[model samples]
Target: MARSQAQDVIRCQYCEDEPAVFHCVPCGDELCPRCKVFHLKSKVPSGHNIVRLSEKLHPTNQVKMCVVHSYKAYEACCEDCQVPVCIACIQEVHGKHTIGKLKDLYERQKAESEHELTKMKGQYKSEIIQRIKYFKNGEREIKTSHKNIREKMKKQAQDFIDHISAILTEALDESTRDEREKLMEISQYRAEAEIFEQNLEQLIEKFETLTESSHPADLILYRKQNPDTFKRFKFPFKINLTLPSYTIGHINKTQNEHQFGKFIRGHISHLTLWDDSLQAKYLTGFERVKPSTKKVSGRSLKISETKTQKGELYHVSCRDDRSAFVSGQGPGIQLIDRSGTELDKISTDWEPAGLAVMKDGSLIYSDYDNKIIYKVSLKKQKKIFINTDYGPTGLCCTKSGDILVCMHEILFSVVKYNSSGRKIQEFETDQNGRRLFHGPWSVCENINDDICLSDFSIFNRVVVLTKSGNFRFTYDGNVLKQKLKDRFNPRSLATDSLGHILIADNVNNAIHLISQDGDFLSYILTEDDGISLPHGISVDTNDNLWMVEENACVKVYQYLS
Candidate 1:
């Protein structure tokens, strides 16, 4: 690397060390770095140069007396050019032209020249900011387009596999398997290629910042002292890439090679047809017992009203162990604990539906009646997060701090939001796989970031979606019906620290705790204190269950051994 050069210093002409600017002595010669003296030089009539560094060097102030006229110093304006004259020559020179302060005129001209450098700095500062914004936005647009096309390719590949599978027969099973495997291999290769593309895009963005235009300063700025004004700007990037890499990908691959690529893949050999026997039982060890000496509530899971509201609670969410937030039935959202004690109110014109706590201690909620997403800071400042096309019903924050939102009456959609409330990406369709769960009522991100959505359309079951929104599997129908003791109308979903999925089965009036892999664990909540028709269920940061009873006010219960 080349060593950086330091800034050059500017100084006055008269004083070598003191920024001696202006002219030298009285001679009007350009001064050194800092001293304040004028050196004036004139061409004499005798063709000799007369220079005066100070007043003492003036020809009129010379020690020698004039040969013709003796006495005191003489002062007269020369008739022709107005040069200073002796008393003896004054009468001979007679009149004069214009007269001005030579030193004052020189000072004004120097000041104007110095200001030109300052004007250049102000112009560059603002210009640099606009250029930076354009570069970043361009990079973002390129990445988004790239991701969308990759998704399209994935869907095309899946369609190809499905077409091959549809003609499966006993005689062709082996061939079909081989064909499917071939497709899978192609997909794997393409997926890896997509990853490389993403990586290359990121590198390109980095390069654009590094190779930006250069800016050299006239003065060594005490940049440290003015950190805000002289903030460091990222340099323009540079990419040492070949042109072919930019055109990039299998869209350019040949048809014959593509057909041959769809053959038995190796990855399928590693996968086995999984069955219920593959599920491991949870070893809680304790013997099951009925009521009476029950550790939790022993009521017959009945629904009873503890407090009747003038209107229904639209959305109730856990704020903490002692408090929660609720929307609906009012103009705004309300904060109450498990005890139904209203601690605060968030005023709004529309009815709120769902709410969740963000990783940074902020509250995120959907105003279904208004079709807007709202965010409240820990300090209680509220702002609109997003305005959705449909009414949002479920809002959740994953362990990674991204927000997952479910909009009602819409084929299951999970839109992700960044910590700052910006929409990042959304999973809305199966262009990547199977169709999204219809009428997804609620959403939760499992320990593995596999998103789980509660679907109540035709099939009342929980649908597990891959991180990319691909349908991993369904958990319902006869198998789930036989394993469960009650109806599984999951209205809300939450994950415990142990990776168990806690689903609020509103129709059956119970909370079902299922194992991480979807094996039935046990009922965590039922009719306790005559609770029924649970509308909203949330587990606080402490994992304490806070539930909103439709027929009652609210309730909090701890699940203990």
Candidate 2:
């Protein structure tokens, strides 16, 4: 502490009566004759610098030098070691640690300290003010409710006094719990806010001292501890308060009108403290990171009827776009547009049972009755794709322009075909050589190129396999104890845009949705969605779901939204 010569008179810090004669910078105080003698004789060290006020000199406080290498000033900070380091120390103990220049470190600490001070003074104060407003509103609500209850009690004073003790007791307990929770939240917020303000004040003071002096080494060490201090300080918890209505309590009808009834107090009914940073994130349209929890509920699948056709649709498949091709129980395959318009129909005597559509709008279907698979164009011309020894009941088109068909005779198996209708591979059993399927009725190809089959055997499960025909997992519907009371009889299978497998649970008259890895997600389409014995399931390019009922009725559903 140094006094300017322009100030003709300066009082002593301790006595405040006499003019200061000496300045003790380490103690940050000016002293008079008697106080200076006491300070020097008592606890003040002998080497402490004491300058005369009239000398126009700066007083020395403390000199910090590297202890390992004496008299050498610390030039940098070792962030990993959380200590100040001289030139020699950096080369030995902190050779691998991140080193920051003392000057740069000091500048960063000052900027951050200023930012913390501003946030606490401005944003935190505003948040606390908002909380006070909520509490005041809740108090007014309680008063209003009390007035209304008192008026009611005045009308039925004698009757209300009979059993009012029980009613008042229940209300008191409920109100105590609700109000206590809110009070605890507010108290915790106040405590945290106070701690934050205190820390900011200390940081600012430390920076101020460094700003007026050359203490870069001290700042460098302090800066290392402050980088992550405000990482979680973006949002303040909000307070929402509400007062519940109160009923009339015991009435002292025999007393004067002023004491007509004992008052029933209203408590805070809705009080919550929540962080608004998540909503703020949504406002920014965050698209880079995946959400921590997947949203799989709170959606409705709407059903709409397509154009009426003559025959019953057995199996359905959609192209790369919204157009769909349906195989019928009769001898025909019909093309339906996304909006339920019938575009074309090709009549065939083979009796198509399974269908799939390519990206080029070419239709491929299997006629199990004739043991023939046909590829038909939009022009109504057809070519024999494959003639399998086993009957092909389910068919699907792959991303690589290949075809996967489910065929069964005595034993169940799957077969893959290339674009030229040549059998590229056959998958009958799992990798462990165990029987993979009992009776697979429908097959689907997911976005990950994995195979999903809806088996209709006694087990009634969905068998899944990797792209290379490796065993994945089977969904038996046993996990759903509430939904599946009977055996899990699966009829049709399809994959949605979210990589969820949709299986038509024929026994439950609902569709079961599962993750791509075979974990049950949720039922996207159920009986509530107008599903009745859902036998065929398909998804178009627009992610719209198309399903066929057992009674020759077809329905399209808006499922994504």
* Candidate of highest TM-score: 2
Tell me the tens digit of each residue's lDDT in model 1 across 1-561.
Answer: 233322244444445454323433223344542233233334432222223334434443333434445652333334355344445555554434443433344345457756744644654444445445634643554565567656756876787778757745543776667678877866776777777678667756644544453233412243434455324433333334332112324554578445433332111112222323323222111211122222333322322223535266545667666677766565677776544566777787666677888877688888777778888887889888888877787988887788888876535567887666666677767645656677787888776557888886777888886555656566662344554457567787877545567777777777777765677766766654355777777767665666776554666666632
lDDT of each: 0.60, 0.73
- Candidate 2: list runs displaced more than 4 Å: 1-297
Candidate 2 overall lDDT versus native: 0.73
Which pairs of residues collide in model 2?
Answer: 1-25
What C-alpha lDDT, on a 0 to 100 scale, does residue 239 get in candidate 1? 31
